[model samples]
Target chain A: MLSKPNVEVSNKSMLGRLFRKNNKNIIGIFTVVLALLFISPYIYIVLTSIKPSSDAISSSPTFFPRQLSLENYVTMFNQMPIIRYFLNSFTTASISTILAVFLGALAAYGLSRFSSKTGHAFLLLTLCVRMIPMISIAIPMYIIINVMGLIDTRIALIITYTAINVPFSIWLMIGFFNNIPKEFDEAARIDGCNVFSAFIKVILPVSLPGLATAAIFCFMLAWNDFLFALLLTSTNAKTATVGISEFLTAYNLDLGPMTAAAVSFSLPIMVFSILVQRYIVSGMTLGAVKE
Target chain B: MTKESRVSIYFFAPAGIFMLIFLFFPVALLIRDSFFEIDMIGQGRGAFVGLSHYVDAIRSERFIGATTNTIIYVVVAVGFELILGLFFALLLNTAFKGHGIVRTIMLAPLMIAPLVSGLIWRFMLNNQFGIVNKLLYDFNITSSRHAIQWLSDERFSLFSTIIADIWLTTPFMMLVLLAGLQGISPTLYESSQIDGANKIQTFLYVTLPSLFPVMIVAVLIRTVDAARTFDIVWVLTQGGPSNSSEVLSTYMYKTLTRYGQVGESSAMAVMFILLLLAISSYFLFVMFKANKK
Candidate 1:
C-alpha cells in the first residue's frame, strides 16, 4: 500500500512536469507563428507597392526586392485623381463623423438622463435601424437621393453616413454616459448651469475619450464606405473607396496602376487606424463588460 | 412635461428626425416599391404588381441560387472566422511582449475598405503572375502549369472570397473575444490550476463558459454582417463564371440595376430583407435570453 501511493504521486509529478515544459514551448511557438501569419499579407502589400512594375509582374515574386522604388506611388498620383479622391474622402468622412458624434452624444445623454421606458424603446428602435442591411436601403436611397437632387454631392454622403452611424454611435455613447456618475451632473446643475450647458462644459470634457472613440469609428466607417459612395457619388464628389473601384474599371487588366491605386487608397485608412488604435479598440469592446 | 422630459425631447429630436427621414423613411419606401413595378427607363411608369414580384423572385432560379450561396458563404466564412478568431484571441490574451503591435497589425486588414481589400486580394490571387501562385510554385507545392484559377473558377471563387473575408473580419472576432477574455478573472484560472486542472480542462470549464456570452454576441454580429457582404464579393467576382459565386445582395444589384428588372429586383430585395430580419431577430432573441440568464 505504501509503495502504491508513492508510485502514484511520482507519476502525477512527472506528468505535471512534462505538461508545463510542453505548454511553454507550444504557447511561445504558436504566438510567433500567428504573429507572422497576421503580418505577412500586409508586409507583402507594402513590399509589392514599392517594387518596380517589371518585378511585380515577374513569374516568381521576390520576397525582398533588390531595388526598391517609389515609382508606383508616383505613377499612382500622376495616373489618377488621387489627390482629388483623398480630399473628397477626407471632407465627407470628417464632416459626417463630426455631425454623427455630436448627434449621438446629445441623444445618448438625453436617453441616459431622462424618460426611462420611452428612452429604452427609442434606443431599441435605433439599434433595429442599425441592424437593417445597407443593400435593403440601397435602391430606395438611390431613388430618394435622385428625387431630392442630392446625388453626387458631398452633403448627400454626409447626411446618409450620419443617419447610418448615429444609431451605433449613440448605442456606444450611452454605455459611456451611463458610466458617468449622476453626482457630476447634479453638481453642474447646482453650479448655476442648465442641462445643456452642463453637458457642454462638464460632461463633454470628461467623456472625451468615449467621444473620441465614437468619432474615430464613425470616421473610419464613413471613410471606408464603398456601397453608398458608389451609389451616391459621381466624378465630382467620388470618395476614395469609390474612386479606387473606378480605377479598376478604367485600368481593367493593367496590374501596375491598379495595385498602385490600391496601395494609395489603403494608405490613409492604415495610418488613421494606427493613429486611433487605442480609441477604436476601446470603442469596439465598450459594452463587452457591464462593469 | 417635467423639466428633464422637455430637455430630453429637445436633445433627442434632431437625431430622431434624421434617422426617421433617412433610415425609416427609405425602408418604408423600399417596402412600398417592392409592391409596385417602377420602370427606370420610362420614368417610373409601371403598374402595381402586388405579390407578383415576390412570387417571381421566389420562383427565379438565380434568386434561389443566390440564397443558397449566401447561406453557404455566411456559414463557412463565419465558422472559420469564429474558430480562427478564438484561437488568435486566446494566443494574444496571454502576457506577451509586442502583443499590442501584433494586435494592431492584425487589425490593419479590417481598417482598409472592403473594396480595397478585394482589389488587393484580386492582385494576389491572380492566376497568372500572382503572388499566391508564384509562392506555391517556388515551394514546389504546385506546378506553374497547374496554377489554380483563383477568381475565374466557380469552385474556387467563393473560397477566395472567404479567404479575403476571413482576413478582414477575424480580427473583429479576436477583438471581441479579447474583451471577453479580459473579463475572465485570473482567480478562476488560479483556482483551477491549484486543483490540478490541465490547460484543456481549465479552458473547457473556465475559459469557454466565461467567453460564451461574448462569443454569441460576436458570432451574431459577424453572421449578420457576412450575410450582407456585397462590396468585397461584388468587386472580386461580380458573380462571375456562370453566377456560381453570386450571393443575394449581388444578385439583387444585378437584377435591378444591371438587367433593369426592377420588379424582380425589388421582390428579391424584399425577400432578402425578410431573411435578414429573421436572422437578426433570432440573434437578438438569443442574446436577450443569454443576457437575462
Candidate 2:
C-alpha cells in the first residue's frame, strides 16, 4: 500500500514536469500559426497580382501560380490613369497632413499654456466634432464646395481633408503638450522670445514625435477616405481608393488588373504603417493607454 | 485681458475660424437643408417643409432597415472582436520566441486600407475562382467550391462584410487588450494562485475585473467607428442583393447621391447623429460612474 501511493505521486509529478517543459514549444507553434493566418490573405493578394491574367481567373486557382508575370500590372496602368490617381492621393494626404498638424499644434500650445473655460470648452467641442459621422455633412460640404466652384479638383480634397483632420490633430497634440513643462516656453520667453516664436523654437522641436504621430494618422485618414473622395472628386482628382473601386464595375469582373491595382494601391501604406507601428498603436486610442 | 490671455487668443483664432467655416458651418447647413427642399442641379432651395422629411425617414422602410442593419453590424462585429481580441491578448501575454515578429504581423491588417480589405475579401469570397472556398473544399469542410455564395447571396452578404471588418480591426483590439493585460499587477495573480485559484478562476476574478476600464474604452471607440463604417460595405456588396446588407451610411449615400433626395438624406443624417450621440453619452456616463469609484 505504501509503495502504491508513492508511485501515484511520482506519476503526477512526471506529467506536470512534462507539461511545464513543452508549454513554451506549444505556444511558439501557436504564435507562428496565428501570424501566418493574419498575413496569408495579403500574401495571396500579392501572388495573384503577379499571376498572368488567364491564371488569375482560372477555375482551379492554386496558392502558387503556374506562371508569374507582370502582365496584370501593365494592363492596370494601361486601362486607367493609375499614376495620376496615386499622385492625387499622395499630394492631398501630404498637404493636408502638414496643414492640419501646423494649425493643430498651435492650438494645442495655446490650450496647454493657458487653460481657461473657453479653451477647455473648445477642446470638448473638437472631441464632439470628431464623433460626428462624415455622412452627416456630406451634402452640405458638396454644395458649399460646388458653390466655391472647386469641384473635381485636388484643392477641394486638400481643403476638406485638412478640416476633417484638424480636430483630431489638436486633440492628440494637446496630450503631448500637456506633458511638456511650462518652464520650457518660460525659459524661451526670458530670452526675449514671444509666445509664437518660443513655440516655433523650443516647443515644436521637442514635440516632433507627437507631430509625427499626428501626421501619420492624418495621412492615413486622408489616404483611406473613400466617402469624401467619391463625393468630392470626379475625374481629375479621383484618389487611388476610388480608382481601384471603379475597377469593380468598370472592368466587368476583371480579376487580374483589379487584384494588381489593389496590391499596388495598398502595398506602400502597409509598409509605411508597419515601419511606424509603434507610433500608430499609441496614436490609435488617442493616448488612452500610457506606455 | 492679460497679455498672455491676448497671446493665446491669437493662437486660437486660425484653427477656430477654419473650423467654423469648414466644420461647424457645414453641420449647420446640414440641419438647415434638412428643413428645406434643396436642388443640387439648379442650385435652389425650395419651400420649407417643416418636419415632413423627418417624418418621411421615420416612415420609410429603407431607413428603418438600414438602422436595424447598422445596430446589428456594430453589435456582432464588436462582440466577436472583444472575444477574439482577448484570446489573442492572453495568448501573447506569455514570453515566447518570435513574439515581436508575430505581433507585428498581427498589426499588418490594421495598416491596410479598409477599401483594400473590402476588395481582397470580395475577390476571395468569389465562388468560382476564390481560394477561400477552394481551401474549404480541399479540407473536406464543404462538398464543392460553390457550396457557399458569399457576396451574391442576400443571407451572407452582411455577414461577409462583418468577416472583413473582423479581420481588419481585430488586431487593434488585441493591441489595446494586450496593453491592458501588461498593466495588470503581478501580485494580484500571485495572491489568487496562493489562494488556490485555478487559471480560469484567476482570469475571471483578477484578470477580468482589472481589465474592465480599458475594455470599456476600447469597446466604445470601436462601437462608434464600426457604426460609421462605409468603405468595407460599400466595396464588398454596395448593399446589394435586394438591399439586404444596406446599413445607414450606404443607405444615406444612395438616397442623396443615387436618388438625389437631398432633404431625405439630410433628415436621415440628422437622425443618425442623434442616435450616435445618445449611445456615446450613455457610455461616457457609465465610464464616469466607474471612475468615481
Candidate 3:
C-alpha cells in the first residue's frame, strides 16, 4: 500500500516535469517576441530610410519599404555639411579619448600603487566631479570658450571632452590596476626596470582590455554629446548630431533624408559597440560591483 | 616633497592640472556668475546681484514647473526602467535557445545616440504618418490614429519623452541586472531549493538580496543620468506644447541661450547641480550602507 502511493507520487511528478517543459517553451517564445518589440524601432528606421521619399511619408505608409533607393543618402550628403560634421566628430572624439586615457592611466597607477589617504580623497573627488550637472559648468564653459576665441573650434571640444572623460577613465583604470598583482611590479623592479619602464612595458600591455574599455566609453561620450556640440559649434565644427537636428527645422520635414542621416551617424558606433560588446557590461558596472 | 609624494605628484599632476583648469575653473566661474548680474550683449559681469537671481529662480513659475517636471521625469523614467529591466533580465536569465542573440539585439538601443533615438522616436510617434498610434488604433487600443498627440498635446508630451528614455536606457538596466544575476552564486539557489523554497521564495530571499548592491548602483547611476537629460527632450518636443516637457536642462538652455539671462540661468544651473548632488549623496549613502551588510 505504501509502495503504491509512492509510485503514484512519481507519476504525478513526471506530469509536473512535462508541464514545466512546455511552460519553459512558452516563456522562451514570449521573451523572443518582447525582444523583437524592443528592437522594432531600429528595424523601422532601416526600412524607412531605404524607402523612397514619396513612400516614406505617404498617407498610407507600408510597414515594409515599398521601394528601395539610396536617394535619401544622396540627398543627405548633397544638402548638408554632413561629411565635415562626421570628420569633426571623429577628430574630437578620438583625440579626447586618447588624451583622457593616457592621463587617466597615470593617475590611476598613482592612486592604485600609493594607497595614500590623499589618493582615496582624490578618488572620491572624481566621484563628486562625475555627479556635478553638466549644465552648471556648461554656461561658464561657453563664456570661457568665447573669451578665448575657441568657440566653434574642434580644439575647444577636444579639450572639454578630455576634461569630462578623464575622471571616468581614472576610476575605471584604477579598478583594473588594482586587480593586477603587486608581485608583477616587484618582479619588474628585481629586473632593474624602474617604475616608468615597468609601467610602460609590463603594466600597460596587461591593461589593454581595461584601456580599451575606458577609451570606448570616452569616445562614445564625446561622439554622442549633443549639448556641448550644439552650444559650442555652429558651421565649422558642428557634429553630425547637431547637423541632423537642423533637418527638423526645414520648412518641409523630410523623413527620408533625416532617417538616412541618423542611420549613417549611428551605424559606425553600432558596429563598434557590437564588436566590443563584451567589454561594455564590465565597463558599465566596474565601479559598482566588487570582484 | 618626499619621494612618495614626488611619485604621486608626477603621476597625478597632469590630470590634476587638466581638471583644475577646465573643470574646476569653469565651475568656479559658474558659481561666481550665479551671484553677479551679467549682460551678454555688453560683455560685462555687470553688478553684484547677490542672491536676487536665485530669488527670481525660486519664484519663477517656469523654473518651478521645469524643476517639478525634471523630478517627475527622473522618478517615472527610472522607476519604469528598473522594473522592466528587472523583468527582462529575469526572462533572459533562463536557459533558452538563441537567448544570446536576443540579448545582443536588445542592447542595440544602447549603442544608438540619445539624440538619434529621440529623432527615431519622434518619427515613430508622429501623429498622422507615425507607426505607434496607427498600431494602437489597429489594435483597438485607441479610438483613432490621432487620438494621442504625443508631441503636440501637453498631456502626453512629457510621457512621450519618458517612453523614449525607457526604450533607450532599459537595455542598460537589463544589462547591468543580468550581470548582477550572473554574478550570483548558484549555490544559493541550491540551498534555497534544499530548504523547500519555491521559485518566488527563492527569488525574493536569495536573488533579491544578492542583487541588491548591483541594483542600487545601477539605479543611482541612472538616476543622476536621467536627472541631467537634455538631448532627448530637446530633440523630441523642445519642451513644447507650452513647456509641458521642460526639464531643468532644457529650461536652463533656453534661459542662457535664447533668453540671454546668464545670471538667472547660472543660478538655476547651480540649483540643479545642488539637487543632483543631494540625490547622488543619498544614493551613495544607501549603497555604502548596503555594502556594509
Candidate 4:
C-alpha cells in the first residue's frame, strides 16, 4: 500500500511539472525583454542611419524606416575628412596598444614573479595613478606637449595615451601572469632558457588572452578619447571621436550624417566586443574575486 | 642583490620611467604651479601667489556648485545603477536558452565610446523628434506630444544625465555581478531549500553574504568611474541649463582652458586629486582584502 502511494506521488509531481511553467522560463522571458530595452537605442541609431534626412527628425519618429538610403553615409564621406580622422585614430590606438602592452607586460612579469617590496609598492602606486581623472592632468599635459612642440601631431597623442594606458595594462597583465603556473618558469630555466627568452617563448604564449584584453582596452582608450584630442590637437591630428564631436557642434545640424558617423564609429568596436565577450568579462573582473 | 633579483629591476625600468616622467611629474608640476599665478597671454607662470589662488578656488561659487552637483550625481547614479543592476543580474542568472546572446547584447552599449553614447542619447532625447517622448505619448505615460525637456530644464538636466550614465554603466555592474552569481555553488541553494528556509531567507543568509565582497568591488568600480564622469555630461548638457549639472572635471576644464585661470585651476585640480585619492584608496583596500579572503 505504501509503495503504491509513493508511485502515485512521483506521477503527480511529473504531471505538475508538465502543466506548469518553470522558474527558469519566466526568468528567460524577463532577460530577453530587458535585453531588448537596453539595446533599443542602438536599434534606433541603426534605423536612423539608413533613413533620409527629412524623415529622421520628423514630428512623429518612425519605429521602422519607411525608406532606406545611403545618402548620409555618402555625405559623411564626401564632406568630412573621415579617412584622415580614421587613420589618426587607428595609428594612435594601434601604436599605443603595442607599446603599452610590451612595456606593461615586462613590468607585470617582474611584479608577478619577483614580488619584491619595491615592486608591490610600485604596483600600488600605479593603481593610485590610474584613479586620478584625466582632466586633473590635462592642463599640465597640454603645457608639457606645447613646450615640447608636439601639439597638433599624432606622435603627441600616441605618447600621452601610451602613458595613460600603461599603468592599468600592467595591473591587468599581472593578474593573468599570476594565473600561470610558476613551474613553467622553473622548467624553462632548467631547459637553459634565460628570463627574457622564457618570457618570450613560454609565459607569453599563455598570456595571449591577457595581452589581447589589455590591447583592446588601450585601443578603446585612445579611440574614444576626446578631451586630450580637443585640448591638445587642433585640426591636423584630430581623431575620429574628436571629428564627430566637432561635427555635431558646427552650425550645420545635419542629423543624418551625424547618426551615420556615430554608427560607423561604433561598428568596429561592437564587432570586436561580440567576438570576445568572454575575455572582456574576465578582463574587467580580474583581481576582484579570488577566482 | 642576487643576479636574478637585479635583472628584475631592468624589467620595471621602462614602465616606471614612463610613468614618472609623463604621469607623475605633470601632476607634481601642476601642484607646484598652483602657488604661482599664470600670465595666460604670455603662456607662462608670472608670480608666486602663495595660497591666494587656493583661497580664491574655495571662495568661488562655481566651484562649490560643481562639487555639490558632482556629489549628487555620483551618489544618485551609483545608487540607481546598483539597484537596477542587481535586479537584472538576478533575473538573468539562469541556464536558459538564448542566455549567451542576451548577455552579449547587454554589453554592446559598453563597447561604444562614451562620447558617442552621449551623442546617441542626445539624439534620442531630443525635445521635438525624440522617440522616447513618442513612446511615452503612445503608451499614455505623458499627456501631450510635447517632448520632455531633458536637456533644457535645470530641474531635469542632471537627472537626464544620470539616466544616460546608468544606461551605459549598468551593464558593467550586471556583468560583474553575474560573474559573482555564477561563481556561487548550486549546492548552497539546494541545502538552503532542504533546511526549510524560504526564498527571501536564502537570498539574505546565503546569496547576499556570499556576494558581498563582489558587490563591494563592483560598487567601487562604478564609484570610481561615476566620480570621474566628464564626457557624457559635457555632450548631454554641457553641465548646463545654468551649471546645474557641472561636475568638477568640466568646471576644471572651463576654468583652465576657456577662462585662462591656470593658477586657480591648478588648485582645483589639487583638491580634485585629493578627492579621487581618498575614494580610490578605499577601492584598493577592499580589493586587497577580497583577494586575501
DockQ numbers for every candidate?
Answer: 0.55, 0.67, 0.68, 0.70
> Which digits, one per residue and each the tens of the lDDT, describe model 3 over residues A1-291?
355657888999999998988888888899999999888888899889889887776656678997899888888988898899999999999999999999999998888888847556766877788788777778999999999999899999998999999988988888789899989988998999988888898999999999999999999999999999999999899988999888775333677799999998898788889889988877876766666
Q: Per-residue lDDT of A43-70 in model 4, one digit per residue for the tens?
A: 8898999998778778789879999989
Off by over 4 Å in 2: A1-21, A116-123, A250-252
Predicted structure 4: clash tally: 0
Per-residue CA lDDT of candidate 1, range B55-149, in tens?
A: 87778798888899999999999999999999888888875666776777777776777787788787788776678887788789887634788
Candidates ranked, most accurate by DockQ first: 4, 3, 2, 1
Encode model 2's per-residue lDDT on A39-80: one tens digit a residue: 788889899999998888887888877899999999999999
* lDDT (Cα) of model 2: 0.87
Residue-level lDDT for A209 in candidate 3? 97
After superposition on all CA atoms, what RMSD does each candidate show versus the true structure? 4.1, 3.8, 2.8, 2.6
Which prediction has the highest DockQ against the true structure? 4
- Clash tally, candidates in order: 0, 0, 0, 0
C-alpha TM-scores of all predictions:
0.92, 0.95, 0.95, 0.95
Reference-based lDDT, residue A5, model 1: 60
- Regarding DockQ, does 1 or 4 come out ahead? 4
RMSD of 1: 4.1
* Candidate no. 1 TM-score: 0.92
Better of 2 and 3 by lDDT: 3
- The CAPRI category of model 1 is medium
Model 4's CAPRI class is medium
Error of 3 at A168 (Å): 0.6
